[model samples]
Target: MTHAPSPASSDRFKSFSEFYPYYIHEHSNQICRRIHIVGSALVLVILATAIITRNAWWLLAMPVVGYGFAWVGHFVFEKNRPATFKYPLWSLMGDWRMFFETVSGKRRF
Candidate 1:
């Protein structure tokens, strides 16, 4: 990812909203998007389980919730690096956004 990816160019991202298109472009595969969705769902489940069980250990699952499935997708399916390394917070937002987009039919698979 040392090479500049045309779609994720920093030139166009003056703000978070401006960066959204670039973020969307980074996720170009359906499997990658699905993996992200699963990871996010697992995150939510972990959060709920943590609150219900009152276990601090469940909070430790964030990395797995966030990175596990995404890493697998990157290595097995996309065969590319995750944008999370470049933008962690926005990468998260992008994942949820992509998930909702897929569910809402705003994104084509």
Candidate 2:
């Protein structure tokens, strides 16, 4: 049986700029956005810890902590599937971009 294309599949983004708007839309919920920002910040902390202490094991927790918070925001608050599943690279980029934007006062937290 032929299945219809999913929304994400149907909307193919040609560039990071194009994908970013959709990414922002997906995180419209205030609480969800805050959670994502927190997750991204924690990822940075984990990376710093891994580098400063020269412990590779700390690296593993990065994804767990980042994705864990993001997933909870998406599933619980947004009630939507994460854009990460369909747009892995762009989603990751979006995460960092959003985090920075929020922290820099360009976007709301």
Candidate 3:
């Protein structure tokens, strides 16, 4: 079987525009994509709850909730390391883009 190149390989994505397609490729597994969507949604809900209730501690849970689901999806379902480790900003942008895409029915859930 042919193997996909590692993200660190000569796949020089010099811009978020270029990196997004690669980000989507990393999350091709259905379950992994769903987990990411749920995590992103939960992060928004948790952040909104924190603001409405004025509970700053709830703010701390955003990353925990977000990364918890995402990491499980990556390790257990996707069987790959998350690009977040190597491309934090781009990965975060990709997460939201994917979330919106899924929600808008442009991409499947």
Clashing pairs in 3: none
lDDT by residue for model 2 over 1-109, one digit each (tens)? 6332233555788788878888888888999999999999999999999999999999999999999999999999999899999999999999999999999999988
Question: Best-fitting candidate, measured by TM-score?
Answer: 3
TM-score of 2: 0.89
| C-alpha local distance difference test of each model | 0.76, 0.90, 0.90
* Count of backbone collisions in candidate 3: 0
Tens digit of lDDT per residue, candidate 3, span 15-45? 8887887888889799999999999999999
Q: Indicate the residue-level lDDT of 69 in model 1.
A: 92
- The candidates, ranked best first by TM-score, are 3, 2, 1
Global CA lDDT of candidate 1, please?
0.76
Give me the runs in candidate 2 sitting further than 4 Å from their true place.
Answer: 1-10
lDDT of 1 at 66: 74
TM-score of 1: 0.78
